[model samples]
Target: MKQFAMLIYPGFTALDLIGPQTVFSTFRDAKIHLVWKTLDPVTTDAGITLLPTASFDTCPEELEILFVPGGVEGTIAVMKDGEVLDFLAARAEQASYVTSVCTGSLVLGAAGLLRGYRATTHWAFREMLPLLGAEPVDARYVEDRNRITGGGVTSGIDFGLRIDAKLQGEEAAQLA
Candidate 1:
């Protein structure tokens, strides 16, 4: 089975997380894991709550993908969290793909995972990527090596489809 681990934190933008998740769900052999530091409810920026299905401590040792979704304030704070960054970095080292939507790319950068990668994010924060050592690009989505990031929230679907094709094949992405 293919396993995917998605990080969840308070104030994460709903669309950034949900759009890609919807696409991933269609794969019958894929196991989607909503992971947080704890197995508790995380409040999104939209005020909706999402219950985490797995905890960081219990995440699968191996994963096909490691995803992070962004929120403006949350992303800023997450960038400074050592434990979270450490977890993400370690996971990225092992996963086949390390991805983010919107400003989630900043979080990946904070983990020291995107040192020389070309990436994209919410337009307003594109300039800020330089602070984290990522080359900022203006695009709906970007793919550099195994690190992919989407621009803004709605672009999650586009990023997801790209990831689907990488995970499965062109035909699988077409079906989605």
Candidate 2:
């Protein structure tokens, strides 16, 4: 099975994670991991709570996708979190695709995974990409090699569909 690890943290935007997750769930041979520092319930900015299925320590060493979702205050805090960054950096080395939605690209940047890559994020955070060593792009989503990043919250659906097309073909993505 293809393993997908999606990072979750307090205050994440629900749509940023769920939209893509809904798309990924359509894959027949993929296993999704809602990962966090611990296997605790993480609440979203919209007050939705999600339980993580894996902790940083328990996430698979090799993965088909390593994903991060965006937030407001929570994102800013995660960007400076050494443990989270370390986990992302380590897992990214072995992941087939490293991805994010909305401001989640900032978290990838914090992990030093976006340096020298073209990426996009929520419009408000686009300028901040340069500070993190990435070339900012204005688009619904930008894919640079193995890194795929989406714009604001709603753009996650488009991002997920695009990734689904890449992995499972256009017909599969269209059906989704």
Candidate 3:
């Protein structure tokens, strides 16, 4: 079975996490690990709560994919969270694919993973990517080889489907 890591942050959008989670979890052969800066329970901007399976430093290192879901608090995270950025930076070195949704793309930018890559984020944050040296793409989902980005919250489902196809195959993705 392949493993995927989902990074959770305070004020994250619920659909950004839940949509991809549902699509990935539908496959019995896949393992999804929800990770956070710490192991404590985290709350979403919409008030959904999740108990992280592990902390950033304790997550499995051999993940097949890493998914960063956007939050309402993207700017603050980009500017303030060293642990989140460090973890993302380190993980990007080994993860087969790095992906994000909505302002989650900002987190990737913060980690320096999206530099020079064409990516997309929430419509509201589209203009901010240039500040990080990323080419902003306007799309529900954009797959730039190893990096996959999606726009807005619900776009996570589309991101998941695209990744599923890449990692598994169109038939397996359809089954998922």
Which candidate tops lDDT? 2
- List candidate 2 stretches off by more than 4 Å: none
Worst 10 contiguous positions by lDDT, candidate 3: 71-80
Put the candidates in lDDT order, highest first: 2, 1, 3
Per-residue accuracy of model 3 over 1-176 as CA lDDT, tens digit each: 77789998778888998988888887757688999878888888888889999888788887788988887664355446887888888888889989988888888987888998999999998999888779999999988879999998888888888887876789978887
lDDT of 2 by residue, 114-165 (tens): 9999999999889999999999999999999999999999999999999999
Candidate achieving higher TM-score, 1 or 3: 1
lDDT of each: 0.92, 0.97, 0.85
TM-score of 1: 0.97
TM-scores, in order shown? 0.97, 0.99, 0.94
Residue 103 displacement (Å), model 1: 0.3
For candidate 3, give the lDDT: 0.85
Clashes of each: 0, 0, 0
Of candidates 3 and 2, the better by lDDT: 2
Model 2 lowest lDDT segment of ten: 36-45
